[model samples]
Target chain A: MSTVVLLTLTGLGLAALYFLVASGLALVFGLADVLNFAHGLFLSVGAYGTWWASGNLPGAGASGWGFVLAVIFGVVCGTVVAALVELVLIRPLYSRTIEQVLVTVGLSLAGVALLQASWGADPRTYPRPQWTQELTEVAGARVPNDRFLLIGAAVIVLAGLLAFLKFTRIGLVIRAGVEDRSMVTALGIDVRRAFTLVFAIGGAAAALAGALGGVYAGSISPTGGSSLLIFGFIVVVIGGMGSVVGAAYAAVAVGLLQQFVNYTSPGLGDICVVALLAIVLLIRPQGITGKVATS
Target chain B: MLRIEGLSAWHGEAQVLRDVDLFVERGEVVTLCGRNGAGKTTLLRCVMGLHGNQTGAVHLDGDDITARKVHQRARRGLGWVPDDRGAYATLTVAEHLTLPPVVGPAPWSLEQVHEAFPALYTRRASPATKLSGGEQQMLALARVLRMGATVLLCDEPTEGLSPLLVQQVGEILRRAKALGVTVLLVEQNIHFATTVADRHYLLAEGRIVGHFDNTDIHSREADLLAHLGI
Candidate 1:
């Protein structure tokens, strides 16, 4: 029973991480129609930004309020970078899909290389709050405290996103833009602004994932985001393209399935995920929600 | 008032509109009659800044707006009801009405929209795309009215609608005209056009070939219908 409990909690923690990364990817794709391969770069930036801020920023450190400040700094950095990317790189290409894809692909490759050049390719020990390194007992199973933190954060993000989408004026524009961007512009609303906004939002979420993911893994590396991004993409595909709720559900499914399968058969979890994706696509090509841009 | 002077548009080497000059005065309803591929939609798109491959001077109230973006053109009180109705799958009817920023002085209130389009109010919570074709058309027209558009560029507003719905659309157009909203409409239904429009322009091979008032259209109805291949 304890083993089951541990697996379930651990799976949920992983799911939280996936949700953070995939939510942004889904929104960016849904609203902007940009595949945004450089999303992983934003994740890496957040992880590294938190790492740097912990040691360098005066008000931020590895623990307590200092750590919180560092994460906020990281999120802001990611947001700015994403907004700039949309304005400078993606905006120029506009409706040219092929050019946009190539540019993002190039940016992703160059961004990682630049990070590796600056920070080195080796993994650095991540600065984590002491409480995160501790353990908590749940259902007779000793679970890492970071698992609870991850789950809590994921819940907050999901609720916040839902509320924002439901209540805010900008959120309404985003929902409409995701459905048909040209129509939004035709209605006298500037959709390019919404595009930039979605990019920034996606960046902040991915960066938050990056900062928390470093705590989960106990290390930060240049390639860490790229590796996890594969699963993030899978989660986005399994979920509907632009639905944040769908991404959340798909993340939980993928995380739990990967955890259970990997436990039973060591290296087969990834293969199983691929199989699951294939089955999902075969069954419902539009995804679990069976819609492209719906919330 | 809206005016287009020396407008020429192309679709990758094939010219769709050629030196088309047109204008709609304040509180007037003008219809552009044309066959398929005759650049009627392209002209509307160019005016709305949706089509880029065009060289023209579009003026809204005598101000040159040729360089304006789509949203800018919209902000200038040019409301567009595309042929497809342009409804969003995710947004509800109420959200659709409220999404566009009101740029004009006398935008309709939600209550006014509800009063004008009772059907839309009843389906306010439903997704815009889920509405029936006629309902969608009503929602589309009501959306522009709610935004307080000064000039409406409506493309095929009555297409695929039942006769009853067609009458409803014609009534709405007449009401818009009465409210001092100028309209430039692309329509194939000549009978409906004559009922609502004050004047008409016949477009052929991307050029303005003929101009007529209601009396002229009534006298040449069969010939014009055959010429338009309708």
Candidate 2:
């Protein structure tokens, strides 16, 4: 049925965004053991960056170019913010888990306040690309072009990330560092560089999600960061805290569940996600795909 | 070449290494022999810059590395194979060898390392957690060798390994010395150390109590064992 196609498409689109955000959180935690509480703020900052770029830059208001430019600018800005946070706050707190949590939470609150002060509390709308606004008919089902674009982008990012992890030297070290930092350092690896690189990449991924959400949903609000943060955390917990593949699968599952719940009763969507998270925890304390840590 | 002068390390308030002075010339295999709580591990950590509250000077190739970080010390040709083996659960045996930045000239290639330690070739794709204790030890040693460390600081490299693997480890160290690599190892096994080392320092209660060359090691074995209470 057309309804099934619509639900699947929409669910996949939403899952892509969730994967982006959750994967960033997972990677940062995996590498540095720094549970970045300020991660959600990166999303809002990125959304705002895109808004500023599209509005201020000349010729950026045109179709595909505008959205693409906005996303690029947003990702860069978000990376800068995350790099600064790492330098100023994260580096010193590497051995102190409680301190890292406290400091990052404070940073997130400050980020939200800064955004409110600069952009005001009003919700801002982001214009979808002209090309993406048109609906396409596929197998007698109507779907927006941007939905397909979102899914394509997700696949590309996932493939690119996997290839990088599997083939590149830095990626190998990052993967190694995630499991045993001291060993990586012993091998003469500059693990700080690895941590920094992962943190920056995580920030960029989160920012990309923000930009994607802004384009597809057409709105950026002050509470956007916290809301996305909750969703990301839920996905991570369900997927396994440090597994990217697990996050992707979990995100899609959550997205589909949310869409189904929304179709039945809008109020029950979030409740369903929480219930699913609880069930996953109860069944596999280590999350769906997580192996019990050995060392 | 490696030197430790007036090295004193502390775990919080209690000092573990007291004015520990030691040296290993290029192409020599030196073992710091001691029992448990003798500050052998702490001395190696201080050299690696892992112990922050240490007041000491570690020199590598006549350069003061006392102030350097762990990674910096490593980059300066100090390779550490800690007792824990630094095995990462996520990385496979092949990745462990490839992950560290290759340093120095004419280091062992992957094929060469596989040939040197045949047990690793079969488990090249196995994660660290899946590998047996002996396999992990071999992987750890292989990693440092592949990284081309001129001075290898191995902390209990043969601990918890089978006797066969221990003999293999001894052979590996002998081969390393023949290739002109310097080794500073902490060992509880005197038999293994005697097979590999040119000189030995007996450590007790965080200080260097005695030193002996290989020629005198046999004569000093009983005295050393008494000091080690073996």
Candidate 3:
């Protein structure tokens, strides 16, 4: 009973982090039709930015204010970098799928190399504030205080994203643009600007997730973003390529599956995920909630 | 208030539009009549800045909008309703009705649009893909109206629509004309064109081959039909 409770809670916490990262991936794909492989690069960038920000603070990682500032700065930095990348690199490659794939993949490689050169491939520690270090018993399972905070943050972000999409005119335009780019442009809306904004938002969300996940893991490595990238791709593929809601559901499902498998057959956990993905593809190639291609 | 001078467009290496020159004054309804593959769609695309590989001058309200971007031209009061009745499969009819930012003076409100096309009200919550062909056409026109466009460019507005829907579309175009919206329409339906347009320009093999006013439409109907091979 305790083991189940522990696995469930841990799975849910992992799901929260996955939601933050994968939602952006789904959105960027949905709005821009760009498979941004460098999304993983943004994750590492945020983690490093947070580390630097927290280290610069008065009490370093020990200060609550320092931790908060680091997280905020990390997100902001990610947003700015993503916007620049969109404007300079991705914008010119619109409607060129093969080129986008090549360019973004190359960008990911370059980003990882730059990180290695700058940080010397060391696994650096991320700041965990004192509050997050506290532990409590929840439903007979030992729970880290930060896990609840992560879950809460995930919920808040989801709610905020939903509200933004539902209530705002820009959000409506973005949704419309996602459906028909030419129509949106013919309607006189700047679809390119909308794409840029969506890309930036996706980057910021991934960065925020990376900062939190790094703190949770207690360390961030240069290759840390690569594993999350694979997980992000799995969640998105299982959910749907361009579906934010689908990504959230898939993230939780994958997290739960991984957690349960760890208890049952640890070595086969990765195989189980691949098998499940294969089954989904065999049944619904477009994905669980993806729109069918017209032709 | 829309003019195109020396406009020529190409699709890759094959030239589609051959130096087409046309103009529409404010409150005039002009139709560019042509059969399939006559470059009517390409001409409209050129006007909308969708066809980048083009040599032309498009003047809107005495402004040289030749080099202007699509959205910029749109913001400057150029509204287009393409033949495909451009609507997203995922967006609701209400979203299609409300998403476009209104540009220029005398824009139509959501209520006003719903009033004009009551069929849209029933499908407000439905995705655009779920709407019938006629409803999609109505939504496309409604979208342009909401944008407060001074010059409305419509491509094959009556294409693939039922006769009843065609009549409804004509009514909408007439209403738009009464609102002083200068209409440059690419149409194949002669009866529908005669009903709404003040003048007609016959296009064939990508060039303006004939021009007829409403007064000349009746006498030259047979010639025009023969030219269009109707």
Candidate 3 structure quality by residue, lDDT tens digits, A34-138: 989989888888888888888774544545776888888888888888888899999999989999999889998998899899987889877788888787887
Model 2: per-residue Cα lDDT over B3-95, one tens digit each:
899999888888888998999999999999887999999988888887778887888889998878788888888888889888877778888
For each candidate, how many residue pairs have backbone atoms clashing (under 3 Å)?
0, 0, 0
Colliding pairs, model 2? none
lDDT of candidate 2 over A1-295, digit per residue (tens): 8888888899899898888898888878777888888999888878888888888876666357776887788889999888888988899888899999999999999988888999888889886788787899877889987788778877877777877877888888777776677767877778888777787888988888888888788889877987888889888888887777778888899989998889879879889999999999999877777731111
lDDT of 3 at A111: 87
Classified by CAPRI criteria, candidate 2 counts as medium
Interface RMSD of 3: 4.0
**Which candidate number maximizes TM-score?**
1
**Model 2 Cα RMSD, Å?**
3.3
TM-score of each: 0.94, 0.88, 0.90
Q: Score chain A of each prediction against the true chain A by TM-score and list the results.
A: 0.97, 0.95, 0.94
Q: In candidate 1, what are the lDDT values of residues B1-230, reduced to their tens digit?
A: 78899999999999999999999999999999989988999999999999989997999999999999999999999999999999988788988888898978878899988887899989999999999999999999999999999899999999999999999999999998998999999998999999999999999999998899999998988879877997
* lDDT minimum window of 10 residues, candidate 3 chain A: A286-295
In candidate 3, what are the lDDT values of residues B88-117, reduced to their tens digit?
876789878777778979899888998999
User: What is the TM-score (0 to 1) of chain A in model 3?
Assistant: 0.94
Of all native A–B interface contacts, model 2 reproduces a fraction of 0.80
Per-residue CA lDDT of candidate 1, range A147-210, in tens? 9999999999998888888789999988887778888898898888888888998999999999
